[model samples]
Target: MAGAEDAGERADRFLAARFDGVSRSRIKGLIEGGAVTVDGATLSDPSLRVKAGQTFAIVVPEPEPAEPEAQDIRLAVVYEDEEVIVVDKPAGMVVHPAPGNPDRTLVNALLAHCGASLRGIGGVRRPGIVHRIDKDTSGLLVAAKSEPALTGLQRQFADHSARRSYLAVVWGVPNPLAGEIEGDIGRHPVDRQRMAIVARGGRPALTRYRTIRRVGSRASLLECRLATGRTHQIRVHLAARGHPLVGDPVYGRTRGARNAGADAAARAALAGFSRQALHAATLGFSHPITGKWLEFESPLPEDMGTLLARLELI
Candidate 1:
């Protein structure tokens, strides 16, 4: 039953507020899928206004079987124990299945590797996923093998206690060399497909960055530490600061065009780069069951290393 305070609130928003751990977007998806009812009548409008004291019911369907098929995809296993498995995910691999990418994901590979151990960890579709990195960003990620591990790892991430760091090659060196980017991030008002630093109604995000090396004024290698794990945090924050990553398709156009004045060698190097120059270099967390601290590191992938070498030569 909706209380007096929820009177006139949108149905999706009302249900989202009443239910904990459920996102408003998920609630809307459920409503649109015809899984919610009001007074026993199915309602699909997410924006329907709620009346005080009205009864609402939601039907939670049994989780569907994960559709992704396991394949013998190669994975770079970093560290593994009975509770968790850490992998150095390469670039261009989707972390999980989605609309366009339904197979050949890290989840599919894990299913094959872990077999029945991953049966009930994250959900049918997600399996052991606790966090995710972008498709083009390569780095270290840890997956839970057991229910306790999943719950523990999730709590650590939620509390912002886990340490996640990345290395990125941005177009130009930041003036200060070391600082933090603080902003509220949400979906772009105009572009819908990309994230942006919003003026209002966005989640708080923070990133700390320092220059690791400078490539003669044309570019800089930077190390970034995440304080909050918002989607596209590092990419969006760096772009907002006028230093979009090299080879970042969505955010690098302006900076790339500006770099046209660079010498021929630098131009060629940038042109040869095919994906964003970002890598998840390090990850640290407590073992879910052992109560011991564990940290793992991955070196820059071959392509990024080659780009750096070229930049240095120029």
Candidate 2:
């Protein structure tokens, strides 16, 4: 960022623009935790204003192993049997290992918790994994523990027979109060890191949503059910409808946010929510081996519950 116009810009914004495809959140993480320097001086504040002549640098750490190591991380096991395990995963936990995160994931926790029973899947480190929710979306997830369980569960998801439901606090009430949002979801054409509605070469996705509660017209609590699982499906669909989830870092920006934040306390509550105000409230599926139906429900985590109370949408 070298021009006079770039001088007062936030460091994370400027760096994100220059980094090409890297997210603002990623840049913020680098500035705050992953070492970042400006003009040969260590600078950790993501909001620091940059001088026109300042040169910025960051140390990008090498990606870790493909095989996740077993970690004794605590897990909220909702149900478990020899064939499968269901977990009430908290927010801030990645489901599986990926580029930025290598360990301490749900997979690592499962390995340590299940021991040798959770063997690798087809020589891949991700074993028994059938489906996933976003990293920051608190929810219930099921992992298969044996070969038959994995195959059967995968078949259910593929056939769109597995059931999932999410509760979201959105910026504004949807127009119809209840409806189906259908779109083809794929990677955003420009921002590769985010998913978006695309007309071509994208997979079909369907979300059925109903307004559960309303805070005047400023916001609403919505129950969203998935008919097809796609990356960021609910987020992209609701955002396209102009009612993005509260606190969703991606696909949640809109001019309507100003109206939602009209009140001082509302603004503070909205701003303070660091993760998407979304929770996987329920999940249902058939037991792979027993051919028995199983389902689980999770109440809103404390943070989301408190947010609703503050916003008066409870």
Candidate 3:
């Protein structure tokens, strides 16, 4: 950044001003975590002063591999072109890298399929990914091939211009046939693994939904559209509305409905759902290169299909 700063300025402030995406708190954390150094000595105080000609270094982690090793995992290719590819990713497919799962993600498969075709997307590990869905959510996803396509698709997502829809089977029928749920989402105060609809400090998230069918007294089929995508937004929003999905162990019912006095039949039906009953059913956007409107829809996965058949729409 600044080769050297005046002696009175705080290190955090100096670093924040120089980095485009860094915040003051983040800089402070980095400084306190020994990631920053002054004159080759690790400085743990954010408010420490930097004298003229004092060298500063921030040890940034090396970038992860852009393309992970490809496995022979089968992928359902829904659509593809020179500029982009739409994939019907099955449930249980990790989208990207994380702690325990560092590979075998959809990105790895795409890298193998697309090969050198995927050049610039965040390097070899992540190629062409404009956005992501959770591992358990089976659905269609679009990935970019070229930088222009990546930039254009990202803009659509940022502006909420891309149309994305989902289907879910929730624990209880929402009283209204259709509605919107809006709130700010943030990490749970107590549990790091979960998100919450908190007020004080969180990102705004919105979800809209309409009832597709009422299933008995306990559940409803729904079509949901995301106005603002957030981690676990649909599950959190629906659960907040007191209609958690039927099999959503994380956000919905737990310990089997039999313990809740449901009959064996209902409990079996509920047992059929092991993951959140959610799927990205539809996705639509304008092609980045061709400028033509494109839309793709995915039917309910086998388990959900069977459950819905039992529910009997007729």
Candidate 4:
């Protein structure tokens, strides 16, 4: 079965639901790149409706290994051993090398810290990486030293067995105290650089959040968790719910506080917040080799603390 679906179902969604391990974006990329064929005819439109009993073929590109080089960069190592290394990643640090950012990445620093102990996981570029956080998001990150450790960590993340928590200052209060945001996230139909909440042709993403403190009408502090990991999951979910971050230029910008008739001290403090207020606060998982549970936490970055202090929420 080519994963038969309703006659009016979108082509991209049909293929993604039928094929295990393929992301909705990957499927859409295939369709847009003319790699999807319906009954041997190349299909270019991802939203094209499929008829019942139609067979479609989606060709996925084989990713070539990235040849990343190590640079002499300083890394704040929190913990290290034969199997794993934990580090406090500062804001503005790219987790790994990619196009436009060829050097000065966490991978380069890890290469320097671990030397040849970094085991290649399927590629030279993604050495020792089981998962990753967004650039500009500060927090604790774990890197693997051995192949077995890498495999174990990957399994934990894939099964959602790892305990991961994040802290963020959003634009408004998230109602219901504690609740879940279950939506399908997919690439925006117009903007390729952004993700959107969609009804069809997207993958299911789940984010659980609890309100920690309300930071006036401008924002609120939140502790968030991920039941399913997708690109920009937390940011997208919050923005969709009408509560963008204070300094998140990508999703929505915070209005200037001049309308609120704030005092000089408040204005000066608000100007200091320039980056998206998000941080990975805690991570826990089973030890790859020792079978012992390991957990780590990162202190709030200076920018976050400064924002809270200025707002008198600390």
Candidate 5:
């Protein structure tokens, strides 16, 4: 059963194309979980080449009920209305519940704040989560309180119409003051936990950045704007350009160690910095229900601000 058109296609890719609204990652997970079969034989290898005319079957189990409890956590509520709520999320806070992080997330706090209004927006686990920032990155995020708001926000993000801008302190200044970084981002072939720039079989990603200020020729503050919302888009793009973010544990170790010329204060500041010096400074999108254009901004947190001051002083 070899069809010329379908031969040599990766199993996961082939299945993902056939299944609407299911992600390739999800397809791989299903395959690894023994929920996918080829010609009545269980196939667990997501990368196996697909032969044309073969019968592929997938078993999708019902999602487990999400039973997260609400906690009284304080939030930096920037704006709130009947439709949506915007918060200036601090660094180190996970947006939703995961295996390791089951509680004390933004979702828990929102559950307490929004009460029953958040129900049925983003399903049980990620109710109202339209978009997300990394746990170590801080910045503005908006969550829907109503179904219309959630649908509207999701549409804008899907269409790449939402404007998201971030500020980061990176190891070196870019050659040009402003430019665009374009690449195909996908999972690392070897390290499943990390992402990488791939030659093919990846989604397109674009990041526009400009140098905000140079910190004594050792570091620079850059404003990065996202054209495509991929996981770790800004971090991966800047790291690929050899300007990894300051204090980024995942991508900055080698580059950060090269900052040798800074003075004692600057070195101390750089070493003391804990998380990546990245913040979602600005977010703008149209109101899903009212069709009104709304925007929000957040200033640098105290930790990043103090570090920048020390860099300037040195």
Candidate 6:
């Protein structure tokens, strides 16, 4: 409960603030489980309006144990060592299991490949995972197989020492060609599913972008480097600049090819595109256990390559 000060706010919003490490979806789960009550009646809705002075009682259950089943999934191994493993993750592969994606993740693959050693190294559920790239954004990701590697990699990520570069095809060509995007990113006010630039209660984010190739005057290929890693940082920052990546479902234009001055073939291809035109092209970090500096680069996926080919000839 948020007391009397925040009377009219949505229940999920205030509950999210009050409950640390609990997401809005988790709060809805509590509401569904009859864990929230007010005035002796259980609240069944997550959107209940709270009048001033009405107290809400909540019962939060203990976190469920995370035990993911291993599967014989194929992995595109980039580089591997006794302490760490790097894989060039294809688009559409989840790094770890979550609510909607329960199994068949990178964790499952790692478990099947590494056996018991992969468990309890990083954390439960997502063992051996360090950082994450979005499922639709293909790229290179490194996972630690031991405690020392985990701790070292976590420290590097916390201090923003890990380097990540992404390649994106935005709908419009930016005027400056190359620059930095600085903002405070947080949950969108109205749309909880998306991140946005907010004035308060946001983490500082920075993205540096340079134009690699111009797809005519309306679209361009860019290389974006991250100084800070926030959820959807590159996508949000580029969208905020009015140059959202092509085929981005949440933060991009639907008729982007028309805006890109494309011909009929290109426009049809753009319309048929399924995922964001972004890829994690490069990654660099110090070896967690060996103290060796390591870097890896991935070529654009076939889909992005085909999309670019269509746009370039337009």
For this target, which candidate reaches the highest lDDT against the unseen true structure?
Answer: 1
TM-score of 1: 0.77
Residue 164 CA error for candidate 3 (Å)?
0.5
Each candidate: what lDDT? 0.86, 0.85, 0.80, 0.79, 0.85, 0.82
Clashes of each: 0, 0, 6, 0, 0, 0
Give the Å shift of residue 264 in candidate 3.
2.0
User: In model 2, which regions exceed 4 Å deviation?
Assistant: 1-63, 123-126
lDDT (tens digit, per residue) of candidate 3 on 150-269: 999999999999999999987666878899999999987755468889977789999999998888666689999999989999999998888877767777644333233266666666
Local accuracy of candidate 2 as per-residue lDDT tens digits, 165-211: 99998998888999999999997776656889998879999999999
Q: Please, what is the TM-score per model?
A: 0.77, 0.79, 0.76, 0.74, 0.77, 0.80
Runs of candidate 4 exceeding 4 Å displacement: 1-66, 123-126, 254-267
lDDT of 3 at 69: 77
Q: Give the per-residue lDDT of model 4 (tens digit) for 1-314.
A: 34344678888888898899998888987787677899999887788888887888877766634566667788888888888998888888899876445568898788777777766566553458877888878898888887788989989999999989999887656788789998999988866568889888889999999999887655689999999888888988988887776567687642432333155655565686767788999989999899899888888988999887776631
Best by TM-score: 6
**RMSD list, candidates in order:** 8.4, 7.0, 8.9, 8.7, 7.6, 5.8
Error of 2 at 244 (Å): 0.4
lDDT of 6 by residue, 205-281 (tens): 99999999898545799999999989999999998888888888888853543455355655665865788888998
